[model samples]
Target chain A: MTSPTPAILPERGLADRLTALFWRHPRLLLAVLLTPPLLWLGVVYLGSLFALLLQSFYSIDEFSGVVKEEFTLKTYAELFRAQNLDIIIRTLVMSAAVTIGCALIAFPIAYYAARFARGKWKAVFYLGVMLPLWSSYLVKVYAWKLILAKEGIITWAAEGVGLSMILNAILAIPGIGGNSLSTSPLGTFIVFVYVWLPYMILPMQAALERVPTSMLEASADLGASRAQTFRTVILPLAMPGVIAGSIFTFSLTMGDYIIPQIVGTSARFIGLAVYQLQGTAGNIPLAAAFAVVPIVIMLIYLTIAKRKGAFDAL
Target chain B: MTAAVEFLRVSRHFGPASAPVKAVDGVDLTIAEGSFFAMLGPSGSGKTTCLRLISGFEKPTSGTIRIFGQDVGDIPPNRRNVNTVFQDYALFPHMNVRDNVGYGLMVKGVDRRTRDARAEEMLALVKLEGYGDRKPAQLSGGQRQRVALARALVNEPKVLLLDEPLGALDLKLREAMQDELKALQSRLGITFVFVTHDQGEALSMADSLAVFNEGRIAQIGTPAEVYARPRTRFVADFVGSSNVLPPEVTRAFGGPMKWASLRPEMLRVTAADGVALAGTVTGIRYLGAGSRLSVALNGTEVAALLPAGQPVPEPGATVGLAFDPAALHVMEGEG
Candidate 1:
């Protein structure tokens, strides 16, 4: 003991230190790091889904006006009923038409912004396009409703400008017009597309902007013309963005209840049908079953989108 | 051969007239066919702008650019019979090597078989034959550079514009590639109008060179002509390291004499005294193959390069430096 005792170093092994760290304040660390997200995913998302799924399995007795917990395939069976299937098909067609229309319109605007527009003007132009997004979604949809109505400003202005006859002729085209602008399925489809067009354009503009200007110059230097550069260089690079925008338009059109509720009269979409089932008829199970249809369609869309590198764009 | 590229009194003014920045001001150049011509300058010296004007990327505000005797003022970059290898290489990242090389052929509506064969031939010429399927990201920087070369050369333009092609490579690789590029240009027999800020690159690879200063071509001559007898102080200072001593002409030295410029390598260090300036060695840098001495003579610094194993004077030691009168270049004051 008198011969100068050798100092011993403390052995703090990795596992031992980690164990001690966790043991000190296990609940506190868990709450700090994991509780907020766990509560959000577990309670908000999963709790609602658990109730909805439970409702999907139950049967509602129309005569007794009482809900029964007896699980059956009848609600799912009713989802494929002819009238319901028609609504599903109509929603898909409307979403496809809107996506195509948006892509055609947004491509040139995005290309011009990314390639030609310089300085503050590019930011101003992009901000102008995105300015519509900040406005209330309901107000925009309602504004469109007034514009397209028979006695609204657009029709009155068309008549005042002596373009009423031309407007009527254009509206009466086969598959597009049945009778008049306000009371047709095409009218509702147009309204839906107008409301959701911004969602498609923003993502597309972002994707197209990622293509370096040097790549385009390289293409031109290689003797490609303007049209050829667009086809070969511009289109392929913007594919991932286009697919992403399409997914947004498709899923939103499928799930949206308000737009179709306001504009649709003759042509009923699955979203409107689901709303009627849940709210008007009190057929929660049938509505839940119909909800599963759009989810399935969305899943298929997401799968294809993932395969085409759409997820990477996001 | 006739001039493959010519810019006559070309001036390009950007922005408003009141305070216009003349990127290239009144430049007149004629690049001989099949010659490796280098335009050397620092950043914003208008060398690149001149190249862009010739390549039809930018139009001259007041003058004309002709490619192979035809006016290219109204023509676009793709329409001009000249291709540019941009400083960044500008290879299409989405495309494979073969597609990138054959882009010009494909755009011209050549048959796929012929285009593919031509692409392969170009790839082989660049020694990148097996890298056809690989993207630009997969290749190393040097390999990517070669791919860029193959892509530009495959187009077979009347003139190829290289904007600092070797500026991105490491020192050793750049030197090797410089030799390769010189050999390639000769083999292809295509006129190359290269732009670079590197004096060594210009001197090593160029058949003739133009030194640009403040939006003007200060001097243009062959590498030897320019180096041996620089007309302007800017040219002498830019092209090589020089000890510009303020020496008054004690005697009339007739042939185009102005201020004296003595290149560091031209100054020989010797112990023998007569007909030489005496200076104290302020510093000595023993650079393995050779030694560089910083000598102070009359409060002015003069650098002298001496071969290794030659006795180098220590700091504060007196040394005699001598150079041939022919080696002392007379140059005009800086423009």
Candidate 2:
């Protein structure tokens, strides 16, 4: 047998050689394919993070009103003060509350979508969940402001239905309560829940979709009640999706400033504090340290969630 | 003896009244206690619906269903003493084999120690003793099937419903599982109501099988009775591969019925006459078990299953195909 030249082979080109090379050395090709994105991540994302960390270590010269590039915990010490501590704790509490609330609300909507809603009704339910997300986030936030105002339809309906006393009682509670639904932390929370709800519902539906109908039947066939089936079979399988959604609701609520700035009254949230410190006050070291709070909290969250296999579904 | 499960004119329909799909149309059946019963049918033939009705996953549209001679009309599935092994194996993906197996016990509020011990026993019963800690995803198709069986069997219900549990496995695994299931059912003395579209599996494993066709029972008899003297053309064709002689051939055979059904193996091909019929070989199909020769005669064609070792006759080869005069089973409709 004679060795055939590229011309003699009838199908010869650079593309052919590259294809052959790729087929022979897939790992090398994979590395080559991935390098561009990895380089982009390394330089653009991780590099900026590294720069931010370096800035946190550097301190500002108090007397000269200039940032001095030196390693210090003075900014962190400032961050742990009573006022800063209150903001951090408040943000944590609200995020946790919003996450729990989203879970409680999203589960039924997601369950209805995954299990019962079929054909045209399923499309409608799906559209209802996602339609709010398609509109402008700010528009939705401002819309909530009008809906929750003192003389808004909510208060009017509550009053009209003779539930004004109950609504007032709920609003009169210490931290969360306010004069009206709007112009309060309650308003901010409602808006945050409204905006980030689809994030929770979508992952939950996707997760529930992976659960087989036969498993439910099998559970019933095995003498498990409807409640038992939900607890034993359905809930555990759908946990990763819930956690994936909680990551969105929790992190988004923790880092939000616009909702608070618009609706809240004199409340200094973490995001608002971070914005004021970095953009207005021009305290790079302190602001960098302040910004690290959410990053640190999210890091801890992701690490624990990863350990629980939350990222498996995500 | 009291029936293990009984359905009286059970019917389940779907869609609008104008054009409803009668998934299980007015079928009556009684599953004997401690017998291996199979509901065999093609897809959409309501064998699955029969199994589901037995399991209480679905309620009958109008008819009454009984279990152990008790009217279980209002009883939910959890209230009924029955368990099912789903076709897809339906083992919980999140739970280990032990947890999945022990779930029924756990649901009954049995203590953890007892559940674990029983789960261990069930695992051993299925020959998966050391695989308790493995998730359903980690197991192979055959292993998953056994796990599903073990899980359902762990409950030790009066009746066990299997919806083609071995269908997902390959041929060898399926055959092995079939024997294993038959042995297990006999050993345990539980009423096994298995459903499958595979006629061979039904014929081999079932002590008494119900042949279902289009939301109705075509025939309910022992495998031999159904295979030998099927009452309907559908049953004759479905029980095993049969050569259905057309009306012309039936007329030739001196039958009054519209069609005559005979097993391919019953027909003998020969080079000499003095047999039942003469035909020309038109096609030869080499099945691994045996060769099938397609013979054509007088605008009618029939296939004969010949012995495996013989040289198949060439196309247009003149041959005689013979069968016993009484071997032909005549059918009334759809010749």
Candidate 3:
């Protein structure tokens, strides 16, 4: 019925009382605010990574098609072989090309949407750019396959328009052949660039949107030409977005196996290699080792991008 | 002096023919060289649009704009010898104060040494000498504004366009910056085209002012001329506080009018025996320097400002007021 007795303790100062208060409401303190990310990093991301690293240490026997229990770096050692290294290098080059291509195309589109387009058209144009992103990525790549095939709509239309001879001649030149675009690595690269273009565009649009139109006006007012405004003010302000979008395009292209498997005849990417080693050969250790190549490349990319303030664009 | 900037029959419209919004409708104005000019209006009254046209942020739908005697119809904004301090300042957040102020020079291919020295000089002029290394975000509002001014001024354009540059600051800071801007404009001897919706801002800083209404120039004059003799009801009501009276002119002295406007301070509160109208005090507001009393005179509300030490009329007390005839402006109602 009466109030509970107050706890008696040694006399303490304001600092000690403040610490005690913090301890009492620890949920209102630090840990509650930090728990979500801590759990994600500790349990999901790092745990899965630890498991993958452990698997990479096991050796795969060629004839038996079984993983050895004993710890070994043989799988990783095998990854440095000429064939595997070629796949790794090809992936890097293709990813870089796609990222650069996307950046080039996206910059103008984003600039137009941010600065020139007015009222409802701005939203409509941006939505058109983003609509492909919501659709299935696989479907979009598959659609490109049909368009690039030998008897595809594009080739038929080119022939119907009497430009097929010119197109065929260009395609027949040494490195580029008369064979269908679907049968070449260039086909895979084109599809990769097309499918992931929106990823680059949306972020660039967001970044360009953050740039005040006044800044561009200010640039022009200072006697800089339209070209100069783009180069100086617009380009510098949109750099963060460019880098951010590049990261997405580069990493996504590096790790994608589906487009290459469907559209390419001879091109072999690290992602396709990983899929082959795991799915067909039943060599989990080797596949895991191949996964490390993309992970390492992405880590290097992230470090460079972070240093350039790309994350601030988020 | 030659006109530093001039707009001849300039008109700008947006959207399709079925529904076009005329942002600037046939405005003809001439800004004198080395003078600070202000375009004042309420929002959507085309003040900012007019500034944009002069600054080359926008081109006229039809007509010509001349800067320092050059007809700049085909010349793009960048090629124009004008710079603008945008309403939001638009300082590059990624660049430090030095780089931001130096950007215009850098784009012109100036050497780093020359650009940096000039940028530092401008930074000092704006009283931001030590702040050259700080980013725009790191500086306070007033500091950012100064940096924006320095950036615009470093280009040494013949005309400087400011779009409500002091609108973002708090009251005290705004007043200080207003004076600073006026003094800066005078010292540089460069023509300034400033746009603001605040009447006080226009009256204080402008050497001459243009009042815009519905995308048209309503009137243009020096501050005192505009304040003393507004040509329209809108001008009289907008430029300052005035007691607009709706009166049937049973007797007329100069012009035809159904209403007249009188400045509150021009009305002398008097005893009931010697005044034209009888009124009862409705309310009183005590300002530090002066007190204002609201009176109901002939079924219309009239406000009069009195000295602070004057005796306050009670709310129900009967009172009389008289206004100087010279200070009264007769105006026609909106047709």
Best by DockQ: 2
B85-182 per-residue lDDT for model 3 (tens digits): 98899887767889899989988999999999999999999998888888888888899999999999998989999998998999999999999999
DockQ of 3: 0.54
The runs of at least 3 residues in candidate 1 whose Cα sits more than 4 Å from the true structure, single-residue gaps closed, are A1-77, A178-194, A264-266, A302-314, B246-257, B270-276, B280-288, B311-318, B332-334
Residue range A1-314, candidate 1, lDDT tens digits: 46565476555799777767878978876777898999999999999988888888787897985678898887787777898888888888887787787778777877777777889988887787878789888998788777778887878999999999988887778766645565666677777667677777777778888887777877888888999998888887887778877878888888887877766465677788788889988888888887877778878977886786544323
> Which stretches of model 2 miss by more than 4 angstroms?
A1-33, A306-314, B272-276, B332-335
Using lDDT as the yardstick, the better of models 2 and 3 is 2
Better of 1 and 2 by DockQ: 2
Q: Which digits, one per residue and each the tens of the lDDT, describe model 2 over residues B8-88? A: 999988888789899999999999999999999999999998898888888888899999999998999998899999999
Residue pairs with backbone overlap in model 3: A220-B78, A223-B78
Encode model 2's per-residue lDDT on A93-160: one tens digit a residue. 88988898899899999999998889998899888988997888888878888899998899999989
Instruction: Report the CAPRI category for model 2.
Output: medium
Best by lDDT: 2
Best-matching candidate per TM-score: 2
In the range A213-310, model 3's lDDT, one tens digit per residue, is: 77777777777777887876777778888887988998888888888888866678888888898899888998999888888988898898778665
Q: Cα lDDT of model 2 overall?
A: 0.87
Rank by DockQ (best first): 2, 3, 1
Report the Cα lDDT for residue A267, model 1.
69
What local lDDT score does residue A243 receive in model 1, on the 0 to 100 scale? 80
What CAPRI class is candidate 3? medium
Better of 1 and 3 by lDDT: 3
